[model samples]
Target: MDDIAAHAALIAARRPRDARLRRVGVSRAGTPLWLLSLGRGARQALVVAGPHANEPVGGATVLRLAERVLADPRLTEGADATWNLLLCLDPDGLRRNEGWLTGPYTLGRYFRHFFRPGFREQPEWLPDGAAAAALPETRALLRLQDELKPFFQCSLHGVDVGGGFVELTRDLPGLDRRMAYAAARLGIPRELGPYDTLYWPRLGPAVYRIPPPRPRDLAAAITEAAVESTWYHPHRHGTVTAVVEAPMWGVAAVQDGSPPADRDAVLHAVSDALRHDTRVLKRLLARVRPHLGGTPDAARLLAPVDDYLLVCPGLADAWDPDTADPGRPLPALTAGHLTALGIAGRRIAVRTAGLLHQLVTGAGRDPSGALPELDGLIDAGCAAYRDDSGARWIPVARQAEYQARVVLAAFELAGRHGARARSGEPDWGTQAAVPMHRE
Candidate 1:
């Protein structure tokens, strides 16, 4: 957190006349949230970094992106867009994840220090009465969104282990293809399987359309709330919202589109593994419930576990052949896809155990009597995941570069489209001839 603050300060200081940095709001922990605004164009482009606390790659991406745009006037001038960059949306949660920020970048180390807020706690996905009820960080972002009403918005996010992918609220012509090509240039494989955004419609290779909200029940409503903010910007201002998902670790399997020899068996096995991990997490949570004090932080710590417990069952059920519709065949299940699923489940369990271990041993507590079970669970889970996934650590700089290119691509697409609309030109479905930035 200090490093990010210092970097932001340095960036602002470097270009004092043009770069404007100010405190937007205070986090739940009283940490100041900063927004750095640059450029002087008619259209506004908002780039939010580190919306998910666990995904710290965006921290580097935002800093580098700010520097790139500030140095290259053509980027801002040609795009005709003023860029508003938020360094980190969830500082309080991010502080919890700082242990692994400067790291060996191994899967075990990453999972050991991992800290992801529950869906409800995420700044991007606030409920209806967010102004009063949501985290101060979330409210700050909402205020920014309302104030900027940007024509282009990109939320920088990443996965622990998988091929890179991007999700767009609107299919902005050739932007998806361009972003995928950029990531590919960086040797980041396009995620071919349905890993994170399972039901979202595929717009192109490694590009997905963010699914629209369709809430029929409370659970569905909660899920919708988690993603509603992505649509909020677009629905109000026709903003082209792009979610850049870079992977921390690259799995060659995720790039392979071939179906497993026995697809149903693979799916069922993945489902069984997830179910088992869910059960383990539930048991661990139950054991730690007594130690958790009556505090908001404690609730925050427990929320992800509760969310996993709630959602994992349905997710596991969906993988069952008996439950899936026969008419709608399942997508190709690659070895990498199955590995990603297994790793995701183990990640949840390990993270839950990690947090629980912190609570039990934190605050000058005696280490000898602390919960050994929690430590064991975390260590075992991390080792199992590391050994099984066969995932390679992707450098932070590489991930940031890939994400920066994606953001730039979005900018070019939006600028071209806006220019066309202004001249009363028809919406020609031709691709934008934006120059790619090679490292």
Candidate 2:
């Protein structure tokens, strides 16, 4: 974080008049959250990086984007949007993940060092109580939102493995295609089938309309109440929020939308893989539960594992062939679907193992003898992905470039239309009438 602060200071110094670095809020761990403001235009755009600490690609993207705009004024010369870049929203979590920041960029190192906060700890998805007592970081973002009411907002994100995709809060006609083109220009493969998002309305290839809040029950209602996503900023300020997702590693299968020859086999295999991973984690959690004391950090560490156990069964059930409707034929399962499922299973397993390893080792005692099993699990899970010959490491620079281009595309679209008030719930079926511009 000191390095990030120093870098931001240097950038601000370069353009003393136009660029200003301000401390927005302090992280839960007391690290200062800094926001770099650049340009002076009629509209405002907010670019957030490192929302999920494990996804560090956005951190690099933020730096590249700030530099790009500074180097070439023409990039945003006529675009009437002032750019506000938040380098890392969750600095505390990012610090936990610094182990692999300076890395060999291999899958083993990535998973071994990975750390993601539980849903409750995340600023964007804070529960109602948590939101009421928002983390300093969350408070800072709220203050920024109120202050800027940005016309366009983008939260940069990346997957550990998969093809590239984008999620939009408001559909800007042609923007998805343009963003896909930008990513393709950088040689990033587009995710054509289900990857992380399922059931989301696809605007175009690799482009998805983020589903609106729909709480089904008490639990869902609480979860919905906690969703303070920048995506929802559209409701308050008519902001068009776009989330750009790239991948640290690329899998060719994620780019293939063709249905697999053995659809039932693929479904069964994916479901079994997830169920197996969930069972492994559940057993490990049971072992570790007695050791974990009632502390915020302990809860935070356990949350992901607990949540996974709760959610994975339902996900697995959805894919179970016996559960499918007899009258309605199962949707054609793509090779990408099978590949994504396998990757998701490996990801959950490794992440659960990594977090549990931290808890066990940090407990200062190991009476349960779970450490050996955890170490083995971590190694095996990582090797499962790393040893795959089909997986290819994606360079950070290339990923950053792809993200930057998407940001530019959003800016261009915004500038062409300009900010306009959006009334009522957004009609998902139609393109938003508001114009978007670049910063």
Per-prediction TM-score to the true structure, in the order listed: 0.87, 0.88
Give per-residue lDDT, candidate 1, residue 244.
85
Candidate 1 lDDT by residue in tens digits, 5-30: 78989888989876889999999889
lDDT of 2: 0.73
- Model 2, position 114: C-alpha lDDT score: 74
Query: Which structure among the candidates has the greatest lDDT?
Result: 2
Candidate 2 ranges with C-alpha deviation above 4 Å? 129-133, 216-228, 292-296, 324-332, 387-389, 419-439
lDDT for residue 182 in candidate 2, whole number 0-100: 79
lDDT tens digits by residue: candidate 2, 64-157: 8889887777655567558899988998988888888888887767766778877667776535533474677777877788789887888888
